[model samples]
Target: MEKHGLRERKKQRTRHALIEAAVRLFEDQGYDQVTVAEIADAAEVSPRTFFLHFPAKEDVLLADADLRVDLALRAIAERDPAEPLAGVLVRAMDQMIAHAWDSDLPTGLAALRARLAASVPALQARLLQRYLTAQADLAQALLRAFPGRLDAITASALVGAMVGAVGAAALTALRRGDGPDEVRDAMRQATALVARSVT
Candidate 1:
């Protein structure tokens, strides 16, 4: 058990190192200019090891998203059944924001990822695809949580509206050169707006 725990910790450290290296390089030199091998070297790992953790360079930018989505799902699953769907969603959003603020990644990495996604067509496409998947997952979770209270269509629309609102606000903040706190504030306001509209 101790050995397994140690192995998991070591893997996590490597993953964190690679993400930090990639973010730093992408920020300093631009994402398009940075190579996988360069990111691996920056993290003091071989390219092979990097590939073990991430399928492609683009995947590194979204490495944390899977965990975030899981947290959202968990929030919905653990929420009080008597609570309205909107309230559950708000709770999930709050949890996500708290997680982002608590992440080990360097400050402004989220904004940097947003900027990169805007400028890089491939990254933008990948981000959109990921967004759609997350929306579907959230919608499904909502339907499961509320059962007869929410149909598939209503659940999907709610998820779409919530994601769209927060995404647009965050992007606008980043475009305006706002800092991380401002970006987070924008998302918070967006979340509140959606919650109010639903409930």
Candidate 2:
């Protein structure tokens, strides 16, 4: 068990290192100018090692979003069945925020990534695609949790509203040069509005 734990920790370190190096390089040199080899070199890892963690350079900017989706699904699964769907979603968002705060990642990384994505057409497309995928995943998970209480359409709409509201708020905050706490506060406010509208 100790050996397994150690291995997991080592892998996490490598992944974190890669992300930090990529974000710094992207910020300093621009995302399009940074190569996978350069990111790997900055992280003190081989290109193959970088590939093992992320399929492409764009994936680095999106890694946190993907993780949050997984976290939200888990939160939905573990939520009280009697709780309202909107409340569960709000809780999930809170969980994601808490996790982000506790993570070893740099505080401004998400905002930086958002800025980069907005400037890069390819990254913008990728971000939209991931958002759709995450919305579907969250909707399916919500349906499973609530059983017969929700139809697919309703589930989709609820998930879409939550994702869209949060995304818009976060983007606005980032564009306005708000720091991480302000960005999170903006998201929380948007989430609360969505939850109230649904309830």
Candidate 3:
């Protein structure tokens, strides 16, 4: 068990190093100008190791972008069966907000990823793909968590409403150059609005 834990930690460190290196390189030279080999070298890892963690260069950005999506999905999947849909969604949104500012807030990895995705057409496409997948996953999870209480259409709509509201608020805050607190407040406010509309 200890050996497995250690191996997992080492893998996580390598992954983190690659992401940090990629972010710095992208910032200094712009995303289009940076190469996978450069990111691997900066992370002090072999190019093969980089591929082991991320399938392609574009996958790196997607990994960061999907972090919050993964968090929310996990939260929804693990929610208590008896919990209301609104309550489960609000809890998930709160987790996502916490993750948004986990590093540095105003100029953090999350912010940088969002900015890059906005300006880069390739990243924008990839983000849209993953976001749609996340929305479907969330809807499916809600259906399972709530069982007969939610139909497929209702589940989809509920997930869409929550995602749309929170995503719009977060995007607005990012564009406004809001700090971490402001971003959190915006998302929380969005969550509250959704909750009120539903219940």
Candidate number with greatest lDDT = 1
Candidate 2 structure quality by residue, lDDT tens digits, 1-199? 9999999999999998998898889989999999999999999999999999998889988777777778888999999867887789898777776666555224567778777876899888888899889889999998899888889999999988888988888789888988777777888898899999886
lDDT of 2: 0.84
Estimated TM-score per prediction? 0.93, 0.93, 0.88
lDDT of each: 0.87, 0.84, 0.83
lDDT of 3 at 6: 100
Residue lDDT tens for model 1, 15-116? 989998998899889899999999999999999999999989999888878888889999999998688778899998877776776662235677778778
lDDT of 3: 0.83
Query: Candidate 3 at residue 99, lDDT?
Result: 79
RMSD of 2: 1.6
lDDT of candidate 3 over 1-199, digit per residue (tens):
9999999999989998998898889989999999899999999999999999998787886555477778887898899767877899899888877876675364456567678877888878877887899899889988888887889999899989988898899878877888888988998999999988775
